[model samples]
Target: MHITFEKLLYREDYQIKLDHIVMNEENGNRLALYFRGHTDEVMVLIGDYSCNYFELSFEADCVLLRSSDLHELDDGVEFNTIPLVLYKDSALLTFATAWMGLKRDTSRDWTHYAIRAFEQDFHVLSPRPPVFTDLGHKMSDFTVRHSFNLPTES
Candidate 1:
C-alpha cells in the first residue's frame, strides 16, 4: 500500500492533523485514517522509531474505511485525520500501526473521545506523524498542552 499526506492547522487538543490517503496495488483498494495527538503522544509514538532525523506522535482517534463508499459508509472514516507529533522522523508509519487494532479498538476511551474532548484532552496510545522536508511554519509557535499515557504491560 501507498500513502499521501497533508498537515492541518492547530486545534484545541492537538497541534496538527495528519491527513492520509492509502492505496493498495493488487486489490486497488484504499484506506484512509488520521491521528490527533499531543507532545506526549509524540514521545510514545516515536519511542521506538529509528527511521530518520525526527518524527511526530499523537494520541490518535481514527475512522477507517474504503474510498469507494465514503458516503454510504457515513459511519465516519476518520483514521487519517488527527493531529500528529514529530520525532526523529516526520513520516506516517502506516504499516507499523496496522496490526495494532487502533481503529478497530471500540474500547470506551476510544469510543467516547469526541465528547470527552470538550471536558479534557483526548488521549490515546497510537500517535501519528507525517513526513515532510518543511511545513513552512515554525513548530515552536503552536504549543498546546501535552498529555500522554504509556500503557503498562500486563
Candidate 2:
C-alpha cells in the first residue's frame, strides 16, 4: 500500500492517492480497493481527533495507529482506520489523556486540562531527535515483524 499526497494547498485542502491496495486471504485469494478524496474537514481522516490535540492523550493505546504502518499494508482489505495524528511523538501525551477521557466521559474538559498538562510535562521530556540514517531499515524490520500476520491482498 502506498499513499501519495498529490498536492496540498493552503486552503486546508489536499488530495491523497492510494495505490497497490491488495488483500490476500489465507487461501491465496486477493482483493483490491482504491479511492481518492479531498476534504476541508479534517475529521474525515482524523476521526475523534476533530477535538483539540491536547484532549487526545486520554484515549487508549488501541485508538492510535501509525500512519507509516498503514501505508505498508496490502491495500484492498478493510481494516479499522484512525487519525494519523498518532504518528507524531509530540501527540503521545494527548493520546494518553484522551484514553482516560473516554472512560470518565469527561472529554469536554480535555482541551483545557491537556494544555496544562503539556505545559507541565514539556520540560520533563526532551524534544524528539531526528531519526538516524538507518531508520528506514529498522522501520522495515519492525513492520515486517508486526504486520506479518496481517492478511495480504495479492
Candidate 3:
C-alpha cells in the first residue's frame, strides 16, 4: 500500500510489519507503543532526538516524520533507523510526550529527558502506560512474517 504522509507517498507495509514485530517477535511483553493524540490525529513516538520530533504519522497515513526538525525539511526525515531502550528480554520506546495543550515546554512530556528553563539537562520520569481494557487493540494490525528462536544451552 502507498501511504500518503506529509505530502509524500511511501509504499511500504509499515503497520503490518510493525505489528508483527511487537506481537510475535518482542519477547516477554517488553515492547510497548507510546502514542499521542495530537489534535484530531494520532502519532506514535519513534525516536529520541531532543530537538527533533520523530513519530509515526497517523493523520492520513502511517509514516515516519520529524515534525519539528527544520534542518531536515529539505533532506526529508530519516525513517530507516529509530532509537529505542534495550531491556533484559525485550526493547521498547525510549520516551514520548503526553499531549496536553499548546503550553510551555516545562509541561511537555518526553521519555528520555526534558529540558527546563534553567537546567540544560533532563527532567527524567517514568513511562506512563495506557489503561487498555483490550490489550490486543494496541497491536491490532496483526500479521505473521517470521519467528526467531535462540539455541538453548545443552
Candidate 4:
C-alpha cells in the first residue's frame, strides 16, 4: 500500500487547512502494512535532520503527524536529520535517539540521542532497504515493499 499527498492547502495565516490524502492498497493487510511503512519513513526523515523534530498524534481512527522548526549546524553544513517525539493521544512513547546516519558518520559527536518512555509498549519492526531513484536535479524518490504472514484460527 502507498499513500500520497498530491496537494496541500494552508491558510493565509500559515496554518494547515487541508491535505489531499490518497491511499493505494490491494488488501486489508496491505493497508495496515502501508501505514507502518509510512510511519517508518517519517521517523527516519525526522531522525536525520538532528535539529528538526516531529510530533505524531493519533485520534480514534486517524493519525496526525507534523514536522516543524527545522535547524542545522552553524557551519553551513547541510545535515539531513530530524528529532522526533512519538505520541499516542496525550501519551509520549519515545524520544528518538541518534541512531540514524550515513555509514561514514557513525561517530558519537554526529550521533543524536533518543529516549523511550517506560509506560508505552511499542514495537518497530526491522526496516527493509528502500528503493531509491533520482528524479532529476534536487529531486528523488523512495519506495518500500512489505509482505506479511496470514493469520491462523484462534
lDDT of each: 0.30, 0.25, 0.23, 0.22
Write out the backbone clash pairs for model 3. Answer: 95-111
The segments of candidate 2 whose C-alpha lies over 4 angstroms from its true place after superposition are 1-3, 6-11, 15-35, 38-62, 65-92, 95-154
**Best lDDT among the predictions, by candidate number:** 1
- Per-residue accuracy of model 4 over 34-93 as CA lDDT, tens digit each: 111122444333222211121222112222222221122121223222222122212111
lDDT of 3: 0.23
Q: Is 1 or 4 the stronger prediction by lDDT? A: 1
lDDT of each residue in 29-87, candidate 2, tens digit only:
32322223234234223222222111111211123233443354332323222111112
Model 1 stretches with alpha carbons more than 4 Å out: 1-16, 26-30, 34-36, 40-154
Q: Tell me the lDDT of candidate 2.
A: 0.25
Per-residue lDDT value at 59 in model 3: 19
Error (Å) of candidate 1 at residue 41 is: 12
- Lowest lDDT block of 10, candidate 1: 110-119
Instruction: Give the range of the ten consecutive residues with the poorest summed lDDT in model 4.
Output: 8-17
